[model samples]
Target: METINARSWVERFIKTVVDQAGELTELDRRAGDGDYGTNLRSALRRVEANLAGVASDAPDAVFTAVSDGFLNTGGTSGPLFGMWFREFTRSPELTTAALAEAAAGGVAVVQRLGKAEVGHKTMVDAMVPAAEALTAAAGRDEPLAEAVRAAASAAHTGAASTESLLAKRGRASYVGENARGVVDPGALTVALFFDAAS
Candidate 1:
């Protein structure tokens, strides 16, 4: 089987999101602003389309396309996605280690921007774990694709574990005790991206 490239990863992300938007939206409605899924879906389609012309071999190009597309689309998610791609752009080499580093950098930027940390029940919950998993896999000299898959799996587990956390950021934070036991919308969104990229 052929390993998926950056372009393929973006395509899969778009499709996965477009397919799961409604389900995610319903999940978000309970504890969030109820528009998380819709916001992601709309931004993803534009990013996906912008990426079609980018070369699969050009990881930086792909990241730039994602950043530009998301920024153009405009939303809280747009800037978040742009930050992620900006981190990705900092590395020119496309390797398992590079990908892991980029993911970690992206998580750092999000943490800085959102002023949230681990246990906040935000996307950082999933992203930080995913980046760690990827780094471990890279240290073990795993294939790039396999490392990404491991990271994605870890991200999903992190998202699920958010059910026990209290929201400390975003609209859900206002709910306080009522936010406990609810998985964060942003965490789920991160899981979706990792799943597709993997």
Candidate 2:
């Protein structure tokens, strides 16, 4: 199958996040400040609202609009995700391998900004594994849809793994051991992205 275009990917992600906003917020309440869902929903709404003015056939333009929308929103996730999508614009194409590298690039920016690692119980936990899975799938010559399916599966596993981890970053870190048994909302949000891609 062909790779999904930028507009379709963004629209699907916004729809998925909107549909799961309450669940995401509840997850955050268990271990975080309980605003992740709202923050993401608000950011995505902005992206959706601005999408109409962008070139429907231009992936770079669409991604830029999405980045701008997220960056304009108020939230840690907004800026981080905005940076993530912004990296996509640097790629000349959106093939599976290029997408994987773009995702890795985004993870690097998030890590640099957040000072968090894969085991830090942050979105990096899911994002790192998803990038790896995407890269591996690309190496195996998988189609874009199949590669993203692998990424989504890996992200889901990574998000679930956070349930057993002590928070080492973000507000949950303040909770220490008490953060265990609750999945990281950021990780779940990353999982949702790949899930929507699939």
Candidate 3:
């Protein structure tokens, strides 16, 4: 399968993120700081402005615009998401191999900078699973749409799993037992992005 439509994919991502900002923020209010949804929405606004000047459908150009918004946005999760989006700019195309590589690379980078691991009740939980799913799909020579769906499903499941775990990373860790039963906002954001892709 070929790569996804660069502009279309990111466009869907922005719409979904914006549409769910309230829920995202609510999740953060329960688990971490209450500003995640606001910060994310602000970053998406920046993305909108950035996208306005984009005349190309090329993955590199489109993804770069998307990355710049998050990279420039304030807040911990925003910048980490920026860096994750930045990984997509590494390859010119979002083919199965490239997509898998970018997701894995983004996860590694986020883990390094955030000092997060799977079971941390953070975005890393969803991100790792998504990347793994993409990698496995690529290995199996799965079609792009199928691979994307698998990745999305993995991400959603990973995000949902966070509700049962106590936080071990990020601000959510500070609230102790209160964070339990609340989904990780960052993880949910990751799930939302993958869902947008599929």
Identify the leading candidate in terms of TM-score. 3
Those runs of model 2 whose alpha carbons end farther than 4 Å from true positions after fitting are: none
Question: Model 1 over residues 1-198: C-alpha lDDT tens digits?
Answer: 436577777778788878888877876787777887877777777787777766655778887888777776644666776787788876666688898899989988888898878788888888889989988988998888788889889988999988898887777788787778788877887788878876
**Regions of model 3 farther than 4 Å from truth:** 1-3
Query: Per-residue CA lDDT of candidate 3, range 67-149, in tens?
Result: 99999888898889999988989887678788899999999999999999999899999999999999999999888888989
| Total backbone clashes of candidate 3, pairs 3 or more residues apart or in separate chains | 0
Query: Candidate 3 has which clashing residue pairs, if any?
Result: none
User: What's the TM-score of every candidate structure?
Assistant: 0.91, 0.94, 0.97
Candidate 3, residue 59: the lDDT equals 82
lDDT of 3: 0.90
TM-score of 1: 0.91
Per-model CA lDDT versus the true structure: 0.80, 0.85, 0.90
Candidate with the larger lDDT of 1 and 3: 3
What TM-score, to 2 decimals, does candidate 3 have?
0.97
Q: For residue 69, give model 1's deviation from the true position in Å.
A: 2.3
